[model samples]
Target: MLIDGLQCGHFNRGVFEELRAGAVSCVTITGGFWQGCIESLDAITRWRDLARENADLVVLVRDAEDIDRARAEGKTAIIVGFQNTNLFDSRIRFVELFQDLGVRVVQLTYNNQNEYGGSCYEPEDSGLSRAGKVMVREMNEHGILIDLSHVGELTSQQVIEHSDKPVAITHANPASVIPHKRNKTDKTLALLKERRGIIGCASYRNICAPEHAESAEKWAEIVARTVDLVGIDHVGIGTDRSHGHTLADMHWMRMGRWTREIDYGAGSPENPGTTAPLDWFTEVRHIGRIPGALGNIGFSPDEVEAICFGNWRRVYGEVFPGGK
Candidate 1:
């Protein structure tokens, strides 16, 4: 079974059915990005509606048992997760509230600095404030997995050092592979492995060089290298699929009230709002390409299974309450 470790897509019945057809057992849906508490609530409500309206194809996840049941029924489980806690906004207590509301993962910062810490894009990276430290403990206590996908280097390091439990950089590539700003560094990856943490290699093209934009073969090689570097037990795919979204949605994701000026987030000023997903991974049904390619690249059957599914399930079990 496949588990997309992180996703921010335009969901609909077609997408849900594609996941089922692709044998995706679960998808950790993005519950909040730059949106606030009220907006977050609205998004959650919409996801609830998706689960209700499409019960035959998809269901919302509240615990690990939900994943197992969904898999058994050949339905995809949608686990609510936050890419950033901008919604929690000034209330430490909201962390627990959101957890109760079914948020299983959260990143402390986004592309820019927040009240808690600096972003990966910020010019000056403030590691973590006193409040951010509080959040680390709060999330650990409340069972919300701490994610460092778009956090600044110092903040990510601090998070790895501070958290008593293992944390995840859920949808980031290794900087060693692509050398992008959002990718994790060698030191951070090593520390995370030492602490028994999880890291999911992303397939977003901005993390890769321009020439390899549509290469699934290269994407598979990237995943294999990640496993070789971090060990298969600690790696999986957080492919960052954004299928079926329009320019308006991309603008909101890139600009997000933080700026009035337009920013070409994916490095193509000529093509402002587009992200390049590999040709073979443009949809959920194409997920088999990565794992299939791994089998040809010297991974044993057990190791391929671990990279595609078992590894993520193991991490979810360790971090989320009742996780399988």
Candidate 2:
């Protein structure tokens, strides 16, 4: 049951074929970021069309059972997600609407602050707002897993304390390991584990140590350190793989209509482009090799299974709840 907790692939028949080749049982793919309701709906429609066209390779996942079904049928399960709450703005009712549309996970904030709360890139961390609290409750009631991968520290902590259900840091690493703002601190990770939450170790290079960006062994070390910090039950994989995307797509993600100028995230003036791909995992199919890497890093077979998929399955089951 290999699962990727987060990815932003441009899914088509070829990409779906790659997922099959990788033996991925399930994957959570982004549906929108900084998109209004109409655009978000259009994105969802496109995803649905893709799944329909590639039904032989993938199926839309509405709950944890769908993940198991996909694996049993040898097809990859697709969980549509959003990296921002921009789709609905202040309209809390859209939570249930999107859930009905097959969106299973959503991040509170993206790279910048919004009505929900501050983001990792924001200067001051304004904790979750009143509207944010309402939104969180709505999502809980509706069975949508809250994600804090790009949210700021203060807001992330408040969300962890406020939400009745356990949340997820879907695609971020430990700040102590890489010292990136996008990564979580040791204190936050401890709090997440205390709440029985899960953290998906992201394979994105910008949030990882520079020397380790291309080394599977070093990356596995990062995963081992996270497992040591928060037991294997709370750890999983989120490759953040953007296969089939180009530099233009990267620019759109970073500067999503917020700034007129190009915002090179984790990059500088000299190298104003997308971050380098991981040497070991330049494509989605390469994710299949991660289990071996984890095993080589002293993880037992059971532990490897947990990190690869079982842990995500547990969290998704708790949040999705028998498909509601």
Candidate 3:
């Protein structure tokens, strides 16, 4: 099980235990997204407490060495990451502190303009702000992997060109494969490759643009298209799964001006009617269903492995070595 990116807080104790007991190999756990500096730090403190209690099942991985060691010891490696840069709060030095706490990946913004850059949902994507350039440089200097998944196209391109190190669009689809603002265009995919970046294909229903409520099979089709455009080597998995939450949570996410206006309507229906309640544990199972779906796309085990975990491991090794 290639544990793609997800929020650490989404899982309850039971779900966490189940995942640890499952065949999961590793996971990039998100700690920050739409959080301010103080709140982000507090979240990490909570993670620290969880890590202490779940030491046997969870090992906080700071670098490549830790990942290898965890695999050898039959433990799940947790790659720390931030889904957004709201924690930065216009302070570049915060990057060093988060890096010290084992954060390896960070997206510049969530769904609106920030000190760093414009979000994909932003109406006017003027590009990365002046502060954003400094933040990019700071991230590069500290060796933290930058993510462009929720960033606007112009801002994404600018960051790619500005950063000395390779960045990742941790979770996105191919625009040609599924046309959506969240999906990356063919041109952006090519540019990322040119800059030595990777694209983690997401399994989110919204990103895949399911017709009504489709099966996980829809996600596999999106991945197949991503692999076609960027090839197996440049592609990887980042499920963007928000388990332990429901359509209400989805509505909460849409409350953001950018996400609300663009993704969801002005307000979620007062009553969601009778939509099936979400099962957090099923998220992992849904991702595991992808390989079978890929078989329909003519992908072999080798290609599947690359998309599942190998590519991410390779990139993680390059970005963080010696577990630091």
Candidate 4:
């Protein structure tokens, strides 16, 4: 029962089949990035439609039991999530509406700041505003898991202290490992653990050191080091594996209506596009290889299971309403 904490791959019957092939019991895939209310609704509707169209291959996950049911039925469970809080459009009550529409996880910010707070790329780090605080409590009341994968450090720290629920850093590595702005600092990781939260080891190559991108063993070492920092129970996999989208779509992800000039994002002028794929994690089905890499790194079978599945299951069960 492997539960991937985050993915943003192209959704299709083929992708769903690949998820089954990977034996991924549940996956929290991105539904919206910088989309506002209307666009976000369209994204959610598309996902719902895809689940209906491919009922034999997948089931929509509203709770942890749905994941168990999908595994028992030999199907993959799809958990819809957003990479930004823009879907709310500053209307707090819409959180419940989106949750009803099958959204379970939401990140507070993307690469840029919005109504909620500052982002990783923003120059200022004002932390959470009063409305951001209200939004946190509202999400808590409605059982939406708060993800701070791309949020600014100051903002993320404030959220960890304020959110009643245990938040998630759904797709990031440690700054101590790679020293990237997108990665979390050791202090942030410590606060997350203290709050009983979990951090998913992001497999995006840019988040990792360049020299180690192609080595599965080195990637597993990152996971191990993260576990060493925040206990095994608070770590899991977030394969930021994206597929089926064109370079234009990728650009949209990087500069979503915010800039006129091209934003290279993690790439530079010499390589101004998506990061090269990690050799061990280019496709969704490649996740099946992760457990072996963990085992090779001296993780016990039970410990490997916790990293690949149990830890995420515990977080989902605790965060989702009626999941426990």
Candidate 5:
């Protein structure tokens, strides 16, 4: 199926083409990531226009019901999402605006602290702020999924306790396996699973060790570890592939933080100096390598299927119904 987290800027066209070719079934299309209100609005508008033009290949899905219907009709469904709450800018009302525009999942922060809470990369990891608590409640009330992939540890814990509904870690690893700041510890993973939350395994190279040279086998190994730690039902694919971008993109993600502006201060930088080159963008062929890697790990097709897309379908169904 089409498993995705965010598709912003000019990369939407190629992504849509892939989906049309049956490359995947559904995509959790992320629109907001570190974008201010104006930027988020503009991005959503562009996505709407694109959806209209590609109506044959794309169906705007707001709920789990639409995903089921789209799969039955052989059309690709797009689930809108956000990687950071910077779009809200600490204003709770914007959650409704984003919900109106079809955003379903939202991460509380990026790699740095924002008004809502500290990022996983923050030095102190102060957890969710007062505004973040409000944001979580608002998201729950509106049926928007709260994603904690890049959020600080304390904040992630607080969100699990505070939010009534199941939260999500859209893209993260098991810290016990890889020991990266971006990864969740085994205890955190267990807690989230206990709460019936979902943990999406990211395919981004950095999340893997020795960042510059990680293969699909390495990714599968990580996935297996996560599945072993957490149950198969709670796991899914996030991929986190920023296809069509370059090291320039990585630098932009760093936002000059590589210069030590905001130190995470706890452990070493997650996958330091392991940024993938622009050439990686054109090589979608690597995606299929995952199945082979899973084979090496001795996972049956049924288990692989769950990790690849089945688990995501189950979770998406619970979150959005007919693009609600």
Candidate 6:
């Protein structure tokens, strides 16, 4: 069964339809980018209703076994997730509250310094804070998977070193592969490999290819290269999508509540908007097309299977024990 590691979609029947068309058995959709606690709760509520509306097609995944169960039934297991830590910002206790609400993954920081730590985009990254350390331990105790996708290099290193369990870089590529800020460093990848952690090759247009090749072949090449660098068990799919979002919605991901000025992530002030995700993956069904490309690129069936969804399954079992 195919699984998308992360996506920010329009969230409706149309999205679920795309997911099924892609033959996705499990997925982790964004519940927040930079939303506060109340907004995040509202986002979860909205998505809960939407998932329930399409109950026949998908179910909210709260455990490792839910993924297999959904796939067995020919349905997609939707894992509600977060991309930033500000929802619980200063309140360490809120991590459990959000976990109770079905948030399986939480990126420690977004694009700048937060209560947790510095972001990759920051010019002077101070790394993880005192509060950030507490948050990590708290999340560990509660089994919330820590995501370091948008976190600073130093901070990402710290989290990987600090967490007793394996963490996930749910969506990000190797910076050597693509020089984007969102991409990670060799040091971080080394630590990740040491921890037997997992990473998702982000399919966001700018991060994947500056020229926007956006083909299944191009994406397959990226994944293969990443696997070569970090080993097979650590890579998966996290095709960041904006299939049905508006310009404003895209802008919101770039500029959250903290920024009064327009923050053009992976874009410029002149070109203040990020491009579409991937040309080949405009429809969710396009994810099903990746395995064949992998096969073409000399990825063995087992390796391809690991990249497709197996690694993520292993991560789920490692991070979320006993249904979390």
**TM-score for each model:** 0.95, 0.97, 0.86, 0.97, 0.86, 0.96
By lDDT, the better pick of 4 and 5 is 4
- Which digits, one per residue and each the tens of the lDDT, describe model 1 over residues 81-193? 88888878789999888888888888889888988898888888999889999999999888888999999988888888998878888898888988978898888888888
Per-residue accuracy of model 6 over 122-182 as CA lDDT, tens digit each = 9988887898899999998887889898899999999999998889888888999888888
- In model 1, the clashing pairs are none
Off by over 4 Å in 2: 321-324
- Residue 289 of candidate 6: its Cα lDDT? 87
The list of candidate 4 runs beyond 4 A from truth reads none
Off by over 4 Å in 3: 7-9, 211-218, 246-252, 256-283, 321-324
lDDT of 2 at 258: 87
Per residue, candidate 3 scores C-alpha lDDT tens digits across 1-324 of: 564744434654565565556545677777766677898888778777877887887788777777767767776777777778877777778888888877788888877778778878778887988998999988887768889988989999999899887789887778787778888888889888887788987755555554413654555676777777877778887766665666555554555333434345212245332223123225444455666666766888888777776777777766663432
Give each model's whole-structure lDDT: 0.82, 0.88, 0.71, 0.88, 0.71, 0.84
Given candidate 3, what's the lDDT at residue 81?
Answer: 79
Steric collisions counted per model? 0, 0, 0, 0, 11, 1
Put down candidate 5 lDDT per residue, 149-223, tens digits, no spaces: 889898898888888877889877788987788989887888888887888877655566653245566567777
Clashes of 1: 0
Error of 4 at 150 (Å): 0.3
C-alpha RMSD in Å of predicted model 2 compared with the true structure: 1.3
